[model samples]
Target: MEQIPKIIEKVSPALVSVVLIKPNKEIQEENQEKDGFVELETGSGFFISDSGLIATNRHVVFEVAGDYWVFWNNKKYFAEVLLRDPDNDVAVLKIKNQGKTPFIKLADSTKLQLGESVVAIGNVLGGLQKTVSSGIISGLSREIMAKDESYNKVFELKNMIQTDAAINPGNSGGPLLNLRGEAIGICTATISDYENIGFAIPSLFVSMAVAEIGAKTKK
Candidate 1:
């Protein structure tokens, strides 16, 4: 769309790269090619609330061991896990005392139509940041199986938003956005062998996660 570039600039500030760090001596031995770099850029995420609540895929933070953090605008912030939805591939994390942060608005996925234009923003392959891909909603209510690398098990994901946007390893948990810059889904998985085929967990799942967190805060 003609207005997509403006939306990208407006929403890019809320995008983040989620990193996982584990204290280990062997980390140096394992990643010699990376020059002793131990941190892993695991996935992408976006701020969903001005208070610093971020929405990402559950599988992104599924590792039980390792501290999670996020980088936005070249600044690092320690992230605290709010919830890892047991039934959905969605999760929420908080950065304390954030004051105010840019966030993307979540949209209703139910109204999404096939052939509608969409965009995917993510850390492509965990290396490229601020990566943007444009596509259209090719399907809806799709069910697919994806391996959760954290558990070495395959699970079926349902009611997913199907898009043609380019997605890679690190794109998981990033936002699948509309031309308005509203997040319509969380970029989740893609078939590597296929072109123009990517799947996202619907934004409703993100909304559910946010609602759960809010419910807990009031308790």
Candidate 2:
């Protein structure tokens, strides 16, 4: 396996914290004020292109009624939602790029093998940024029914990459990378009642989404 330090150095810059801000009506009413907003959610993401395209989980940005922001390299920037695939739980964001931004390469997820070494990097618990965890691919093509209590809906995620890596609440939308520092999946969810069983959307679906979005953008 590649040295963890070197892999982190190569891919950490591309990792970003995704923040969702929403109006805090309760707070506004309590303070007898208006225009108050609170952070609704926080997750992780990574830049995929020099053009400032980012890949994350759709659930991270879903049902947010306020502004979206991205933090990276000691800076914060406004982000625009570019694409969302609820079926696959994938979403893409676009941010302003002054120049080229560092990005991680995408691996061919179809070639993934059982028990392969993998690492996950993300903001953990919505506070600890750039947390890293390593594990092996525990399973593949898993079909999971994820229930979102907030929305009162359940989503069926198909062909997911199952890993033993530690994926916490804020780890959603982060990258699940191979030893080569290539993103093989996008960390999406975990069984809240379980341990060391996390799920990610395979990179093949991500690549397809990116290509579909790119094609539409040109039209």
Candidate 3:
């Protein structure tokens, strides 16, 4: 296997931070409100195609109400949802006016074996950019119940890849890359109050969603 640093260097450009920004209302002179951006949430995403197509978890943008943006290479790009998988906790996005772009190749998740080394990369604590963690696949085909940010909705997530990597809420939608630097899963949830317990959605579903989106766009 190549050095982990080398793999990360090649994949960093394709990684993106997904966020929802709310305009702050600041009444300074009782008439004019200052233009300030308050970030609601900062999740993670990655490029999947040359047309600026990005793959991320649906819950990242689920409650944003269309005010989402992607940060890459020190620039922020407005992003629009192209597709959301109804059967899976996945979503695809399109960067407005963006053409060719860097991307990470999706790998087969079905072949992943327990104890295989992996890396997790994404926004940590909704602000720290590109936080990296390494661990082995702790479990697979895990079925767990998760709650949304509002804590009103409880949903079950199935077929998850459990890892020992240090992941948190902000790491949602980030990539779980194999040693080859190919994306094998998308980070979805982490159990707090517990050490090294995180879960990811396998890449099989994500790759299928991307292909389905591409096919729809060509039509």
lDDT of 3 by residue, 11-96 (tens): 88898888877666532344432556666667789998878988898888786455788988777888988887644689998897
Q: What TM-score against the true fold does each predicted structure earn?
A: 0.91, 0.90, 0.87
What's the true lDDT of residue 66 in model 3? 51
Candidate 2, superposed: residue stretches over 4 Å from native: 23-37, 124-126
CA lDDT for candidate 2: 0.86
Query: In lDDT terms, which candidate is top?
Result: 2
Off by over 4 Å in 1: 29-37, 124-127
Flag the better candidate by lDDT, 1 or 2: 2
Q: What TM-score number comes out for model 1?
A: 0.91
In model 3, the clashing pairs are none
lDDT per residue (tens digit) for residues 1-219 in model 1: 788788789888898888887655646565643433367647889999899999998888887666887877777788998999846789899888667999999999989999999988875334476778899999999989888776889888889888988877656688999988999999988986899899999999989888888898899
- Candidate 2: 10-residue stretch with minimal lDDT: 26-35
As for TM-score, the candidate ahead, 1 or 3, is 1
Residue 105 local lDDT, model 2: 84
